[model samples]
Target: MAGTVNRVILVGRLGKDPEIKYTPSGMALATFSLATDESRKDSEGNRQQITEWHNIVLWGKQAEIAGEFLRKGKLIYVEGRLQTRSWDDAQSGEKRYRTEVQGNRFVMLGSRAEQGESPESPRASTAQPTRTSPDQPLEEEEDLPF
Candidate 1:
């Protein structure tokens, strides 16, 4: 009863193209905005639409894949945890707080053709083979000299 969880799952359209940035360490990070909407009948019998915007971030290999495949208006389903960060604006001198989804898993829900991907082609999500080695630990390091 003492455990806590911070998870967020969203299926939405990208508001704009993702921006990829690299740190000094040469790590890849991709940032994008997503929008989700809901429509329902209001008290006046009129349909009302409400939209929520979310900031999404992906790192490492996932970020690279997202940058290459995802685009504006593409519908995607993302499973991630919420993270809040603060930074000082350069010009405004004000503290900026940003909430973002640290995407761990993502699925392209829309048609592959729209993403410049072919339906006949095997995408990364569907192309990868599942791990069958249950007894081996995934984090076990290899003896690479590099």
Candidate 2:
């Protein structure tokens, strides 16, 4: 490999409505939290569902679009790179770090009923998505190297 890849793709529901703000330079900025889920058998052979939370950030027009259309519990697909930023905390005087997905491309997911949109509204709902296409077969556990 000549170069490294730092891409992250997430398909999840918004934990809350996106919050939008403008920079001093008048650029749009949006921030939100997304939740992804996974399920597996525990040591006792009982199934457990786990949810993971991720910080998501969007910029410019994408930020504006996300802020306006994405509501809490809405399903969405975000594609972007992972970034970790560090800052010093004011009260604690300790360095704080945050890892966030700097999403560039966004897509709406799930059916109209799931998104609370009318069946005729295309803007609010979509059939699954690219990576989750039904035509593709899921890889079995044995196929994974780990």
Candidate 3:
């Protein structure tokens, strides 16, 4: 293919509450860890399970929403691209590189009740409406038929 694509999608439970921060320019940034699991029968027929941890990042409005609604152990669906960054470790003075999912959009996977949220509220839907990328226009609820 002439063009290249960098994308990632993950469905997992949050390992902890999102950590929100701001840039010197005041841009919002949210970082969190997600844990995904897989189970299978080993050669000996014993059930085995494996868990993978992913670093997730979100920006702007998406970051704001994550700080407000996401909590440890909550299941979420994230869609975005993979990004790697390197920085010098303060104590060791050694360079360290980390890869993170730069999420442009996400959907909460479980019901409000399952998340310990109020069921009678208008935001009681299992999944939050899809969030657009920073460059894309955000659509109001009235614009959606559902």
Candidate 4:
């Protein structure tokens, strides 16, 4: 292929509540951790499971939505690109790098009540809709031939 793609898709549970912050220019930024698990049978036929934690970042409207709706242990589907950032530690003066998924779109996979939220709340009703980047066009069910 002549072009390169930097896309990532992940389905996981949030490890904790998202942290929201604002940039100097007043842009919203949110950060959170997601835990993904893998299960298999060991050589001894014992069930084994491994969990991987990923750092996730959301910006703009996505960040705002995450801050308002996401909570610990909530299942979510995230689509974005991997980004690595480097910064110098203030105390050690050492360069540190961290890789995070910069989420462009996301969907809450389960019902709000399952996450300890009220099902009848307005936010709950509105929040379940899959959110995508503003640049992406929304596709309606009628648009599908099937």
Candidate 5:
């Protein structure tokens, strides 16, 4: 192909509450850990599950929404690009590399058991619609730059 792609899409549960931060420029940045699992039957005919953890980052207005609506163990679908950062620790003088998913869009999958929230609760407004896929027509999405 003449072009390239750096996209990543994941559906998983949050490992912990998201960490929200603000840059000196006043932009919001939210970071969180997500867990994805795989299940299979072992040779002995027993079920086995494997979980993988991922670091996710959301910036600007998206980060703000993630902070407000997402919580620990909440399932979410995220679409983003993979980014790797390498730096040297100031005190340890050791180089480190980290990979993170830089989210462009997100959708809350809702709490599995709804946290005992009633169907008519006011907090239901916090629920949001799912994200758009690449196959969606550009005209139908919010007017945000890609």
Candidate 6:
């Protein structure tokens, strides 16, 4: 291959509300866990459902937006790249590594008038889409046409 691509796309439900924090530079960072389910046939032809969880992180303005709007059990589509980082454990003196998706863009899934949302709620009118760029201009995603 001439080059390698490190892209990841995920459509899943939020396991919990996004967590937001500010870096020393005052840049926003958000982290969340998404859960996806896969079904497979077992040896007896029985269907088995398995759930996989992914850690997702977004930076910059997108982080603030996600932290404010995204909630547990909300469905969303995320496009990003996979990254792994390592750190030394202070207690045990061992190296620890973790892999997570560094999200560039995300779009909320569902109708604007999703269940449990009031008609007058601001989120009810938004398609809930945004993109992150710490070093580049932020890009806004248009409402997805059903």
Q: Which predicted model would earn the best lDDT?
A: 3
**Per-residue lDDT of model 3, residues 1-115, tens digit only:** 6467776878999999999999898878899999999999999999999899999988877788888888899998787778789999999999999999988777787788888
Sort order, TM-score high to low: 6, 3, 2, 4, 1, 5
- Candidate 6, 1-146: lDDT as tens digits: 65667778899999999999999999888999999999999999999999999999988877887887788998888877788989999999999999999887777777656624566534421323334435434446545555
- Ten consecutive residues with minimal summed lDDT in candidate 3? 121-130
Clashes of each: 0, 0, 0, 0, 0, 0
Candidate 2 local lDDT, 94-140, one digit each (tens): 99999998776677787767777766554621222222224434332
User: Per-prediction TM-score, please?
Assistant: 0.77, 0.79, 0.79, 0.78, 0.75, 0.80
Top TM-score prediction, candidate number: 6
**lDDT scores of the candidates, listed in order:** 0.75, 0.77, 0.79, 0.78, 0.75, 0.79
Tell me the spans in candidate 4 whose CA falls farther than 4 Å from its real position.
Answer: 120-146
Cα misplacement distance, residue 94 of candidate 6 (Å): 1.1
RMSD of each: 8.7, 9.1, 5.0, 4.8, 6.4, 4.0
* Residue 94, candidate 4: C-alpha displacement in angstroms: 2.4
Position 5, candidate 5: lDDT: 78
Q: Single out the weakest 10-residue window by summed lDDT for candidate 5.
A: 121-130
After superposition, which runs of candidate 2 have C-alpha atoms over 4 Å from their true positions?
Answer: 118-146
